[model samples]
Structure formats: C-alpha cells, structure tokens
Target: MKLKELEQLKNEGVDHISSIERRRFLKLGFLVTGVYLGGKALSLAPLTEAQAAEVVPPKGKYSYSPHYSMVIRERLCINCELCVEACNGTNDVPSYGYRTDILERRRAIVDDKYETIFMPVLCNHCNRPPCVRVCPTTATWKDETTGIVKMNPGRCIGCKTCMTACPYNARYFKEEGRFVDKCNFCYDTLLSKGAKETACVTACPADVRVFGDLADTNSRVYELLHTPETLVWVLRPKTGALPNVYYTNA
Candidate 1:
C-alpha cells in the first residue's frame, strides 16, 4: 500500500491497525526490492588471489579472538579499486553496492588547491549496534563475544527501520528484494571456519585495514583502535549511532 493511500485511509477514519502495520512494512520493502537491488550485480567479481593471507597486527590483548575487527588504516588506503574488486568477488555482491563503500569529503587546499580523498566505508560492527535496537522483528543481531553485527534475512519482515536508525548509513537495502543487507564483517568468507582475518584486510594492496578484538588490550586491533598516533574515527559521531568503525587521517 502507498503512503498516500495509507494516509487517505487513516483520514477516512478507518481504524485498521493491520493496515497501519502493513504500511510500515511496505516503506522498508521498497528500499530492499526497489532502489538498491542492483548493488550486488554492480559488485559481481571473483575474490582476490590473496584471499587466504592473514594479518599480523601489533601485539594486543584481543589478538586471540581473530575476528574481522574493522579498522580504517588512514595512511595505507590510496582510494584504489583493488579492495572494491576484492570485496565484490568474495561476496558476489550481485549489485553495485557489494561489501565496500567509499567515503569522500570535499576539502579546499591552500592557494586554490582542491581535492577529495576516498575512504572505503562498511559496517564497523559496533559493540552497541543501533541497528539491532530498531528492527520490528528480531532480524539484526550483534554477537557479544565477536563484536560483529549480523543479519537474518529470514527474520527480516522487509522492514528497513534499521537503515534509518543507523547513523553510519552502514545498513543498505537491495533493489526489488524484501530484505535489508550490509557487511557482516564477511562472516561467511573470512570467519566461517573461525579463521582470524577477512578478505578485505588480506587483499588490501596498501594494508589500510586491521582486524582483531576490541576488548583485549593484547590484540592489535584494540591497540590500534586506541592509540593516539593512529587515527580512529566513527562516521557521523554527531548522529549518535556509536558506530564501531574507526578511521585514521581519513
């Protein structure tokens, strides 16, 4: 049912609670089945040749967990397309929006210099995931031990409230589908066997990303995430999603 039509029904004094609920479902359904359905197709490709490589992060407490703990290595990423191909290939994204998302901010340089730096964006796998809080159905979840946010398409009522609830804009819906989707730290590829890293971290030509645990001080991911020398940022902190994704100079 259309939003306008729903409103019309409400205006007509139709006290149908089911209609209101159905309207809510349709709002989210459009995002999955309508707008971004082609994202996976845009990302269709083969995994990187170095898909099996492992990262040796600096020593820290969380080193033992070996989850794909997302870290934006500010210095190493040159905005190259290698990781893009790597992610699409690994996931068969089936749409242009595969696993990788590039972030660009316009900046003006001195003496009329102007340029923009491209940074890849994806799910940060926050400790306190807002996406989990807003789902009408219990579709999105965060693992306590791994610190990775996960999705269940089976439980998703095609409601995308999680998308708007997220400040990082990490949650994405597919075109002509009926479910919301986003990066789950590549749990399917890198962590399925309980491995220690992700394809994106392994395939990065410049080694800009890091993976590990957030709680263990012994883990490399945790140390890098906390160190002052290395920059770590959550996208749109003002929005208060408390995103776990961290970025250096970017």
Candidate 2:
C-alpha cells in the first residue's frame, strides 16, 4: 500500500492483528523462513541462461544481529552527514545534541606522520549495556532481534544515568526536555525484511554504513567482526557500555 493509503487504514483502525493473524503467521514460520532465505540467495546468485535479468548484483547490505546493532562502513563514508540529516528529519533530534554526530580527530604517527580523520558517532547499542544498569528507572532496553538499544521517554526519570554510562559519548539528554534518547537504528524501516535498507543507509552518499546482524556467522556484519582489519574502539574505554560500533582499519 502507498503511504497515504497505509495512513488512512491506520486512521480507520485497521492496524490491529489479532491472535489468529499472529498464530497463522507463526504456523508458517518454517516454510516462510526457507522461502525468504532461498529467494535471497537466488537473487544474489549468478543468473542462468533461462533467467530474465538486466541489473547486476542488487546494490545494498543486510544486518543479522538477532536484534543486532547497525553497522557503519567507514571506507564508504565521505562524511556527507546524510545519516545525521536523515536522523534529524526522522526523530526531530535537537540541532546541537545530535543523535548522530560527526567527530573529527587528528592523530600524529611516529616521528611526523599526521592525519585528520572524521567519524560519525551515535549510540553503539551495546551488549552488557551500562546505560541500562545506571538507569534510575528501567527506561532503556535492548531489543532481542536487532540489538538496537531503545528509549522509553515516558519511563525515564531524567536522572541521566545513561548519559554518563556510555563510553562513546553516544548518549544525550534533550535541552528542552528532561528525557534520554538515542538511536534505535531505524526499527520502523526494517520491518518489511527485504531489499529495502535503512533511511540513513539509503541516504548515504558514499554508502559507508552497512546495516545487519552481528551474531549470524555468515552475515556481512558478522564477517566484518572477524576481519583482520576490523577495529572496535571505544571513545574512552574506561567509561562503560561495551559498544557494538566498529571501525575497519586500513
């Protein structure tokens, strides 16, 4: 359905799916699971003579976190800030306290070698998240499937426990509001479970951010984790949250 049609249906209260709907979907899990994976592999596989095809390999990436966090691909990044802009437009995140911010740092290597590097910083959506522990109220929780940490503004007491707990400085408190918020990695966008990628990923000019699963051994994110060049660095490791964000070393 088109966006307008979907919104109209929602207004008409057609959004609710009852137990029968849920159970019916559950019953087809095995069959649906195979079809989905098989179809994807087929799409990615080389075309046969009988196959009608034109486009080369479909462009984009996937995540497999079991609720895994979003992956950022640094090499593909040109620091365009489309992710930041998309984020601001999507969540209305404050102008200064960005849910995603670009950070630039200069490092001097041995002797005189020096270079300036820029990286986009945001919530790492960690496992063993310290923000969860420091919360005065249980407002932040990690999703099981995507590993994206989310906020419950209604539950937050605005104590700022989470803000202090993050090592990457990914947490932020709104200036006009007394609530904590961070990236949920576009959960609403990924529901279709198809070639459709996240807004930030799609908006990316350099296509640097790769969103997918961290747990599945065969997933791109998973393979990235094992790559010899991959580097997961905390802005300050001493702070807390064992972040899921990583940078590939060239």
Candidate 3:
C-alpha cells in the first residue's frame, strides 16, 4: 500500500498489523541484517577488485605523508577529564573553551538496566575539510605534511564562517586570540617540539586515545584500523569529510 493509505488507516484507528504486514516486516529485517553482516565480513577480507575500488584514494586528493590521526577507544573512557585538563594546559585553552570534551550516552538494555558510555570528542581534521572550503580569508587549511587542520589566527576576521561550516562543532572563537581556535593534534605545542603524541593521548590513564601516523603501516592507528573482527568508525561519515579521527571499542 502507498504511504497515504497507511496514514489513512492510522487516522481511522487501525493499529493492528496484518499477517501480510508481519511477513513484509520480517523480510525487510532479514535483508537489513544480511547486508550489515556481509559488509562486516567483507571489511576483514583482503582487498579484492570491488573492495580496492572503494578503499583506494583518488589522485590529486588530500593524502598526506604522515597522515596524523587519532583513535578513541571509546569503551575504555571513564570521564575522568584528565585528558581535558592536559589539553587545556598544553594549549592554554580558556575555561570557557575546549579543544576536547566528553559526552555521555545512556541506553536501557533490559528490565531497567542501563549502560552508560563516555565519548571523548575532538577535531576530526578531515581530508576534505568543510571548514577549509568555507574560509574566505584562507585562514584555515589542512597541513600537507601531517593532514592536520591548522588555523592562522592573524588572517582570521572573526567572521565565524569556518565555525559554522565545521560539522563536528570543533571550532571556537577565542576572545584573547581574537580568532577561531581548534585542535591541531597539538602539532605546534608538542609535535613540533619532537613529542610523539598529543597531550590528551598521553594523559589518558586508560589508554583510550591512540595518536600516530595513519600512513605508517607499523603505527598503532594503522594496525587498529586493519584489525579483523573489530568495528572502526568516524563521526559524521555521511558528511564525506574523511575524518582522520576514528572511534572503536576497546
């Protein structure tokens, strides 16, 4: 039946699901489950023709040398806020602002039993950054060497265009700096000083944050991405940003 017919039935207080409706629902459920499971299995297999086509990078794209990325082992985060404190201190972030923060998600499992997860979020530093595209003054751009999204404070006009364009809500206006500021994976603060990891990564007691070069196959981030029977995902993947930050279970 058409959607209008279904609405009409609902308007007439017809709440019962007929046998035909039940069969249709079951068929759809099976189809969805099969497709999901199939994709999971395919991700673990060696790159075939179809898989290679999907995974391979197109020429002239924003592929970087080090391809700096971070992986959040979400299941291990305990909302301690030590990482946040480390980030604020390292970057001189104000009390009103943050380069990283924690979010809470709660779900009811069964019989009033609930599970809560603390999710830590930061700048994704996308390969195809919407913030970079929207910047009129070219104040923000992705670093060619590290693939980290960087900001030039002097060039910013405080127009807030980049702030609006960012899908992750990662950018914030700094009153003292008189410019938009965001996470650069602590590149200028620590990485340039020869540190191997970001402040947040080093401060996490639970080892929840893994920061490294994604391009290097020997790196932890690369191995985590390649691990079989593991689920890896990026936030707002539908935005087509190709974020460098990834999330997965411990």
Using TM-score, give the best candidate's number: 3
Query: lDDT per model, in order?
Result: 0.66, 0.64, 0.84
Tens-place lDDT per residue, model 2, 1-250, is: 5645544453344448754565588879978999999997885343232112211111222222364645666555667788889888867778878778887778898889987677777777665567875676779876655666778888888888788877667778876667887877766545444534556767788756766655556777666656674564444444434456666542
Query: What is the C-alpha lDDT profile of model 3 across 1-250, one tens digit per residue?
Result: 8755754563344458665686699999999999999997785342222111222233223267787889899999999999999999999999999999999999889898999999999999877788987888889987868888999999999999998989999999999999999999999999999999999999999999999987788889888877878888888777766777889994
Highest lDDT against the true fold, candidate: 3
Candidate 2 ranges beyond 4 A from true positions: 1-65, 109-113, 175-178, 189-196, 228-235, 238-240
How big is the positional error of residue 220 in model 1, measured in Å on the Cα after superposition?
2.3
State the displacement of the C-alpha of residue 104, model 2, in Å, after optimal TM-score superposition.
0.4
What C-alpha root-mean-square deviation, in Å, does candidate 2 show against the real structure? Answer: 19.9
In model 3, pairs of residues that clash are none
Query: Over the stretch 1-250, how does candidate 1's per-residue lDDT look in tens digits?
Result: 7667756663445455576686788888987876576775543322122112222233443322434466787656687767767777876676645667676767898999887777788886654457876777878877655657888777888767888877667766765455787887778777776767777777787878877666567777677766776545666665444455677753
- After superposition on all C-alphas, the RMSD of every candidate to the true structure, in Å, is 14.2, 19.9, 14.8
TM-scores for every predicted model? 0.67, 0.63, 0.76
Residue 207 lDDT in candidate 1: 73
Report the lDDT of model 3 for residue 86. 100
